[model samples]
Target: MAFHLRPATDQDLPFARALTYEAMSGYYLQYGLMWSNDGFDVAWAGRENWLICNDNAVLGFISLSRDSRALYIRELHMLEACRGLGAGSWVLEQMALKAQALGVLRLTVFKNNPARRLYLRSGMRIVGEEHCFWRMERVCQSS
Candidate 1:
């Protein structure tokens, strides 16, 4: 199913936090990710969060930060029902277009993220490592 993105505002911050906790509680504990309010600080969400929605309702949120150099996807989470439905691939395609528009050759994904496979399938190849994350890049050809 095709998905849509809506820029999240400060008023949506609390919803973002709640959704993050709901979607990631298991993975967070499994991966020993710091479960703290610090990560969801208001300032951070205001800047990075964007809601992923469809005809039914809001599904999840993605945190993206971009600059002239590269587009950084801080996080991408979806509701349980959205899993295995090709929604993530649709979003990745959109990100690739954004990268191409900006003329950047660098994009990265966390090595441990389950979505790494999706990234690899979408044309981004693992290029390097930094800490626990793997940097990736794919030439963004016009679609």
Candidate 2:
């Protein structure tokens, strides 16, 4: 199935929340930690959330924060079915393009997340790791 990335709307909150919860639950199950809906809701409550959809079904979502110099990838989650299918790479490419357009220098990703492989493949490198997360950055080229 083909996937597309789009700016998330308020109407997409329910779907986004469900995907977030599912991803978190999987992580909790894998690591034996408690996953809470409140945590998901709070993380997505007021951020710039983007939806990865195909024919109206939400496949994944990502949230980001932007500063003058860089964009921080706050959260990214893809359904288990969508993992390893290039959907994650597509989303990261979109994010990188958006950052480049904004004249941002780089984007950041956490270390422990499996998505680190995607970031590295997309040319981001580990700059640091803190709080159990590996921070990565990719410099954008100027026009």
How many clashes in each candidate? 0, 1
Candidate 2 per-residue lDDT over residues 36-63, each given as its tens digit: 7777677777688888888787778888
Can you write out model 1's per-residue Cα lDDT over 1-143, one digit (the tens) per residue? 55788887878677777767786677667656777767677446545678887765787777777777667666677877877777777777777887776654455555677778888898888888976668887777565
Instruction: Give Cα distance to truth, residue 62, candidate 2, Å.
Output: 1.4
TM-score of each: 0.77, 0.77
- lDDT scores of the candidates, listed in order: 0.73, 0.73
Where does candidate 2 clash, by residue pair? 111-134
Candidate 1 regions with alpha-carbon error over 4 angstroms: 22-33, 42-46, 105-110, 141-143
